[model samples]
Target: MATSWRTIGFEKNKKLFERAIEGGELGHAYLFSGPEMIGKRTLAVEVANKITNISVPDILMITSAGSESGQTIAIEDIRKIKNFVSIRPYGGAYKFIIIDDAHLMPETSQNSLLKILEEPNASSIIILVTACPEALLPTITSRCQEIQFFPHPRTIMESVLAEAKLSKANKEFLADFADGRLGLVKRIIEEDSFGEIEGAVKKIMYLAKADINERLDAAQKLTDEKNKAGLPRLVLYWMLYLRTRLSEPKAQKMLSGLLALNEIVNKPQYNHRLALENFLISL
Candidate 1:
């Protein structure tokens, strides 16, 4: 049977796993950091399984002190864990706590957790997983052994896509648009949302090439679809496309316009329709 942690290609982290398995050098606390959907939590869970030898259960597990059933890890959840750590393990040699989305833990909660890290219980391990490690407090980070996970290469991504039985055309588009995020590829394939997004992109491109009102209309539609993020992304792509097909001065103007529009959309108070209208008028 395939091991849980071994499923996501941890060859590069093999040494770390081996050391942990060997037992003596295992750290009391670990921070697993990587982009979202890159299997950080999977590795953490595998480690927990190996340590606890607990039969895999579908329950939501957390490390916080006060979390009720179904609640994600909260400050109270961390508080609840302190009592468990003081006790000895019943089944396995070690007790493991896997904290998912540790970066989302508030400062007070993280600070509360720091005390446990500073004086870790023997035979207990805490694994913290997060997509944005930098957002975590320095004190908490400094107390834990950090492991960083990088995106898989294109070749590996292609292999994963093949295993999923995705169409070749869809796979290529996903590979380009997902920025090596396998999670995104899985979502796109499962939902079959690529065609809709592609149609929207094409419509926006056509509008960009038409009159100012057309561009404004396209922007409004984009915002309506909750694709505000895609607006700047598409504009950048369109500007580059135009650069390849137009003179230097025209390309420069397009780049400047795209950049201005990007800034407008990025503003927290941006009036989407008004901003789009202004951008269209400028174009």
Candidate 2:
């Protein structure tokens, strides 16, 4: 019944949206940009919910892309949004079109979105959420009001974990390991899928010191599809692990290698095994 952003940790973004809503200056389109799992999508949804008076779950026009969507927001997705925007609101005065991972839209699809942005829709709001806004066209970004989300402060994250009623050990693990991503913490806690990452983080040190055979063994083990699901999390934890070792001379180089490998693994056409092996052996 009330418009609230308790689910998001970014205070500035909350205030910004609140102001826009209160002033009746809410824009026709907005771009929400931030790091992965840093709450861009959450804030985008909340903004849409507030403006359209549509209960969060009932907002049928919302769209999101993921690995299953082939990692790109296709032209068909844009077409659906175009159709949604053309329709009038069912119950409320406003309707919404929220697209997550908007940057994943290739140039052509982005052009389709551009057509919508250029044509004014009085009753519709479009929100584009992405971790990689650079992948989107400059014109698309220029058409929308851009809002940036950032990692939650450590104090805020700690308070959130404390309220989750986790065990002391688990609480501490999340506190040290969350890296300001509450989404990641929740996923790891609820799914119990983080064990592989924990082990991998510990093994990173060993892998760094490991010889050719050990490195090759790790590369082989890590390249499986079953294990690939966990690689992103593992790389994330590895980056956090590197944070602690920044005092060492090789820390930057190690992190650079991991970042490069991460980029490769995220692309559909890249060879995950070769990238993993290259990073491991180089370490």
Candidate 3:
């Protein structure tokens, strides 16, 4: 496979980076934001690989996965970036650092990251890859150049489906659910009925009918081990639902609250479970 963003329908983004790189105009910080299962991280790695093709030991790949399960990146992890940047780059090339799930950095971690952003070393290049750019602080975002990605067009998505071995209905299910997320389409093909996303739709009716106590109980259940990564899907579904119902007087408030709660959930410093409980009660 070709090792470039163009490999994943991100030709424009690849060109943008290429121009900056060839012109020697690359910025100190970059924010790569896009929908989940898209190629944000893939492109970041491609950029790094292109620049540091030969022997290089300074690149750092950080993910919230290193933290305790279900928790965001801690202040301690941010310190690694601080320490990593203090050293000058080897052979005068940039010291590349990519932080996947950038939104998972708690407030304290972000503040710590801000210090590095404010006083960026000319030898360092930081790339923050995230699906939720809004979860990051404005000060942090303002310091970085942004590259946005979107889903592939309908024609492109349909073309991909043409190669699948699925039955007509199964193919349609992947088409509707993946909605141009190529990564998601691959996942659905591999996991089928075990895809957690299928469960997000089943909760809308339960959420609507449940009382405060029932909702609170539901919130507790949602925080269990199984739902670790599915929370984003749930939030996205509610946000979309709330947007369509904005004409309803109460829906506006609900939307605002949900948005605020979503931000809190990104920062592990907050009591995310309580936030979910409060959000359910308000609903």
| lDDT for predicted candidate 1 compared with the true structure | 0.66
Over 4 Å off, model 3: 1-6, 54-56, 86-92, 190-195, 210-212, 224-230, 234-264, 269-271, 278-283
Q: Which of 1 and 2 is the better model by lDDT?
A: 2
- Report the lDDT tens digits of candidate 1 across residue range 92-126: 66778888867657677788888889899887888
User: How does residue 146 of candidate 2 score in lDDT?
Assistant: 89
Question: How well is each residue in 214-278 modelled by candidate 2, as lDDT tens digits?
Answer: 99988888777557655665777788778667789798899889878766655434677888998
lDDT of the candidates, in the order given = 0.66, 0.75, 0.77
The TM-score of candidate 2 is: 0.83
The per-prediction tally of clashing pairs is 9, 0, 0
Residue pairs in candidate 3 whose N, alpha carbon or C atoms collide under 3 angstroms:
none
lDDT of 3 by residue, 166-244 (tens): 8888777666556567766766677664345545545754675688888988888877678745666577656655666
lDDT of 3 at 141: 99
TM-score order, best first, reads 2, 3, 1
Give the TM-score comparing model 3 with the true structure, all chains together: 0.78
* Per-model TM values vs. the true structure: 0.64, 0.83, 0.78
lDDT of 3: 0.77
Question: Highest TM-score among the candidates is held by which one?
Answer: 2
